[model samples]
Target: MVFAMLSHAAIAQDQTVIEIQSPVLVIDQDRLFAETRLGSRAQADFEAHAQALAAENQRIEAELIAREQELTELRPNTAPEEFRAMADEFDARVERIRSEQDEKARLLNRSREEARQNFFGEVAEIISEIVRDKGAVVVIDRRDVFLSADRIDITEEAIALVNEKLE
Candidate 1:
């Protein structure tokens, strides 16, 4: 009876020692955006629009400077009331143009953000497939994890898949 009890205890210990695989995984989301082709194209588009806006700003500034110079030249010869009215109109135009340009800048930023959000949405199915393949129950952003084994960092693998799967 004593021998049977000892043997049963040993078997229980062996069963308890069986390895349990980790269900969590990590991905570097920023790396996904920078490394994937989809992300690169989006970034390029945003940058191009931003550069165009900057050029437009410079052109508007040049035109305003020219207008101001013309107004200043006219001040000496023109009637005082007429010159003052022209100056006020110029100030009003400057304010209106400035407001419009600011709105464009804001819209550009908003579009970029929407593009980023759309990119992530496009990648969600890919991530889901990866999670299924890896038998991972949950995937957390790498930035959120305090410490994790490098083996669990799937950003590069995911990037390769994204590049292959996406245009």
Candidate 2:
């Protein structure tokens, strides 16, 4: 009689366990960005800016190398105090240039981040519309998931929507 009672209670408990039936959607942000027109434009612009900065850096580096060679050549012929002053001035200049280069690199990184934020801002709205249309209760990045069927992936759909909206 006790075993029958316990079995009935267990069945009741199992019946009470609720299961979520909501749909889940997945997006591949990297693919979406690369495939979208606005994202492609942003990438090209960023690349051009990076190339320009690199060329400028190379020019500055060449100038510094020349200055260093000149200073080395002058050290042998110059008086002790005069050579010390020149050496100190050269060291100060090199430090200043390094600081400037560091600042430039930081600025480039900031610009890249800003561009990404702006791109995502626009993409978010489109994603929302797609999510609602598909009746998905939750959205997850494709990169974060270990496994998902292609049918559940919304990256291509999101990319299409983004391009259509942006264009």
Candidate 3:
């Protein structure tokens, strides 16, 4: 009896077919490719900027460290006014470095925002074209779609169509 019940359950599971009405078509290719290219460009730009900043920071930090070390070693023989002047200079340098870092961060954020907008614009254009050509009643994210027939997967066609436009 238990074996029979198990067999019946398995057969039911196999027969189960989910159907989606007004099935949502996802243009993942457009999102994926567009975002990928934009992100790559953004990352490249970011990396280049970061490397420049890093090199500059390293030079500044090394200079500051050397100065401090020299001051420490010379403290025994150094005059009070000279020591005070060196300390003040170090403080000024620190403030300048902090301000520069803050400005770079703001610039990086602005660049990223611009890149994201550009990627979205490219993706939207492809989606519009696909909708016009394929007569897609609605386009939705794949995550929102519960089930769909394989035949209705217009993703490849949409990708091809969009690539043509891109080229």
Evaluated with TM-score, which candidate comes out highest?
Answer: 2
Clashes of each: 0, 0, 0
Error of 3 at 73 (Å): 2.2
Best by lDDT: 1
lDDT of 2: 0.84
Weakest 10 consecutive residues, lDDT, candidate 1? 13-22
Model 2 residue runs over 4 Å out of place are 1-22
Sort by lDDT, best first: what order? 1, 2, 3
lDDT value for model 3: 0.66
User: What TM-score quantifies how close candidate 2 is to the native fold?
Assistant: 0.82
lDDT of 3 by residue, 1-167 (tens): 99999999987665442112323456454345444544456567767877887788789788878978887898788898998887788788788988987798788778766766675577577777666665556776555668755544556665565456655
Q: Which ten residues in a row have the lowest lDDT in candidate 2?
A: 13-22
Of 1 and 3, the candidate ahead on lDDT is 1
- Candidate 1 on 1-167: residue-level lDDT in tens? 99999999998675443212347879999899988999989999999999999999999999999999999899999999999999999999999999999999999999999999999999999988888877788889999999987767779988999999996
Model 1: residues with Cα > 4 Å off, grouped in runs: 1-21
Any idea what lDDT model 1 has?
A: 0.90
